[model samples]
Target: MLLRRGILWLTLCLPLYGETVAGRWHAAVKTPSGEEAYFDLEVNHSGGEWQGMLINGRDRNVSSAGSFDGRKLRLEFNYWDGRLEADFENGELRGAFTRQSRKQVLARPFRARRTPLVSPASAPSVDAGGEWILDVGEGGGKEMWLASFEQDGARLQGVLIPVSGDYGMHTGFVDGNRILLTHFDGIRATILDARISDGRLVGTLKGSVSAMVTGRRPDKAGRQELNSSSLTTMKNPREAFRFSYPDLEGRVVSSTDARFRGKAVVVSISGSWCPNCHDEAVVLRMLYDRYHAKGLEIVALGFEYTGEKERDLRQLRLFAEKYKLPYPVLLAGTTENAQQTLGQLRNFRVYPTTLFIGKDGLVRRIHAGFEGPSTGARYAALQQEMTQWVESLLAE
Candidate 1:
C-alpha cells in the first residue's frame, strides 16, 4: 500500500496548488534587449484553464490573449514586426520572440503581482495632441510620430505616425505612472516611472528597437527648420523618369499621357503591407482634397510581396477600400525590382517613396519615406511648411 500512500500525498498537494492560483496575477514584461515590452498577466485555477491578456502599456485597449495552467502560462500574440510567445512560472514570466530575421528571449526576470483596476485619477491624462518627434540616432534610425491620444471611458489609445519608415501603428495605454505601448513592428515596451508635467507627458519610453528614449514636447522653430531643409535639399529637379504600371482593372497607366498636358503629378510608390504608406495615404488624401480641383492628380503604384500581379492589385484595392483612398492605385510588376520596374528611375531603395513631378514633367522631389501628420508637433509644423511649399509650387 506504499503506492496508495504516495497518491494520497499528491492529492493533498494539489489542494495547495489550487489555492495558489485562485486569483489573478500580473507583471511588467520585456524582451531580453529591453526594447519591446508589455503588461502581462493570468487569471487561473489549479485544475482549470487560465486565460489572460497582454495589454499594450501605451494603449490599454490594445491587447492579445494567453492561457495558463496553475503554475505555468503561455502567451501567443503579434507585434509590429514579430511574433511573441512568453512563459510564466512561480512569480516570474519569460519567453522568446521572433520576427523578420531575428529572434530574442526574455533575459530579465519579471515579477508577478495582482494588478488592481486603476481608478480614474490614477490613470494618465496624456494630452498627446501636440506634435511629437522621435530622434533615434542615425542610419535612418528608428523614430516615432504621435499625433494625439484619445480617451474612451476608462480606456485610452493613441495613433503613432512613424517618421522613419512604414511601421503600421503604435497603440497603447497609460496605466497609472506606467506607459505600455506596442508597435506594428511586432514589438512592445513598457515605460515605467512616467509622469505628466507642464501640459506635456514627460517620461522615459522604452522599446526593443532603441533604448529608453524620452518623450516630450517638440520644439516649433526647430521642427520648421528641419522640414524646410529636408524638403529643399532636392539636388536634381531637372531629372525625368518613365513609369508604366497596370491599374486595378488590368489597364496600363504611364507617365507619358496626352491628358497630362501641363499639370503637376504626384506618384506614390507604396504597398498595402506597409504602415508608413497608410499614414502617407491619409495625408495625401487631405492634400488631394484641397488641391484636386487645381488639376493635381495622384497615382499610387503598389509593389506588393505577392508574386501574382492580380493578387497584388486586389490587395492594393482592399487597402484602398479600408482607408477610403481618394486616388487611383496601379499595380506594378511583382518582381521585387522596384528600380527596374520604374524603367529609368535611379536611387530607388526605400519603400513608400514619393516622386513629385512638376508641371514641366520633370521630377522636382523624391521624398524617401513618409512621415505622417500625426508624428507630433514637429510633424504638424512640417505639414504647415509642406503645405506652403506645395502652394508655392502650384502657384508657380
Candidate 2:
C-alpha cells in the first residue's frame, strides 16, 4: 500500500518538476542572409498524447509526435523532412530547427517565448486589405510575391503567391501600423512583420533565411503570369522523350517499358530536398489516382543533390513512402547528371518541371515550377486546366 501511494506521489510531482511547454509560442529564426523569420506554434495534449500544430500563412501541418524529456523538447515532423530540438528553461525555448537531407543537414538557430494570442480583440486599430505586391531582394536576385489580404477589423488572413509556389495561407492580426502574419508546417516556419507607411508596406520575410520586403497595392493589372511553359524548353523537339533509370529496388525502368507504353505519361523532374517538389508530388498523386485507369501514368525522375546512389535512393524511398506514391520514382541521378541524361532538354531551371507526353509518346507540354494551393484561385485554375488537358489527351 505504501509503494502504491509513493508511485502516485511521484507521478503527481512530475508535472511540477518541469515547465510545461503547452500553449502558444512565438518563435524566430535568423536566416543566412542576416534576416529574422518568425512563426507561431501551438502545443497541446489530448488523450495523454502531446502534439503540435504548425501554422504558416494558410498552411497548417500537424506534428507527427512531440515529447518533452524534462529538459529538452523534441518535435518531429516526418513529412516535412525536419525536426526541432530545444532546451526549455526560464519560460523560454532555445535551440535549433534542423532540415535533414541525404547529403547534408542544415540548421538554423531558433528561439521562442510564451506569448499571448494575437487576436482581433487585442489588435483594434488595423485597417488594411486588398491585393499587394511583395518585392523581395534586389536587382537580378529579386523575386516578387503577389499577396491578397482579407481584413476584418483587426483580423487578417491572406496568401502570398511566389513563383516557386505559394506560402499557403497566413493568418494574424494588425496592431496600428504594424501587421504580423505567421505560418508553421512542421518543416517550414515563416513570419511576416510589416509596417504600413505612406501607403507602402515594408517588412521582412523570416524563416530559414531572412530577407527585406517591400510592398504596394497593385495597379489595375491582373495577376502576373508567374508560371510559363517557356521557362523550361526542349533543345530538340523531334527527339523522343526517353530515359532509363533504376527504381528504388535497383530495377531498371525506362520510358519504353511496357507499363508506360501507349499511355499518357508525366515525367516529373524533381528533387527530394525541395519543398516545391513535395507540393508537385501531392498533386501528381491525386491526378494519378483519378486517371490511372484512363491510361495515365506518372514517373517521377528524382534529381537528387547527393551524387551518391545509395543515399539518393534512400531519400527517394522516404519521399515515395511518405506520400504513398503509387507510381515509380526513379533516380535519374544527381542534379548535374540530369542535365546530361536529359540532353534533349535545355536550361532546366526548376526542381519540379513537369513534362506531359501524349499517347503518341511525344512531348506535348512542359510546365515549369508549381503554383501549389497557396495561390488560391490560381491553384484551382491550374488544377482545372491540367485536368481538362489530361481528359482531352485521354479522349484522343
Best by lDDT: 2
lDDT of 2 by residue, 30-147 (tens): 5665454556777776666778766564565677788876677788776556788888877788998786644678787878887743443355454568888889877787777778
The segments of candidate 2 whose C-alpha lies over 4 angstroms from its true place after superposition are 1-12, 15-19, 33-35, 46-49, 101-103, 116-127, 171-214, 221-224, 336-341
Off by over 4 Å in 1: 1-36, 39-182, 185-221, 224-236, 343-346
Q: Which 10-residue span in candidate 2 carries the lowest summed lDDT?
A: 116-125
RMSD values, in order shown = 9.4, 3.9
* All candidates: TM-score: 0.54, 0.83
Report the number of clashing residue pairs per model: 31, 14
lDDT of each: 0.54, 0.77
RMSD of 2: 3.9
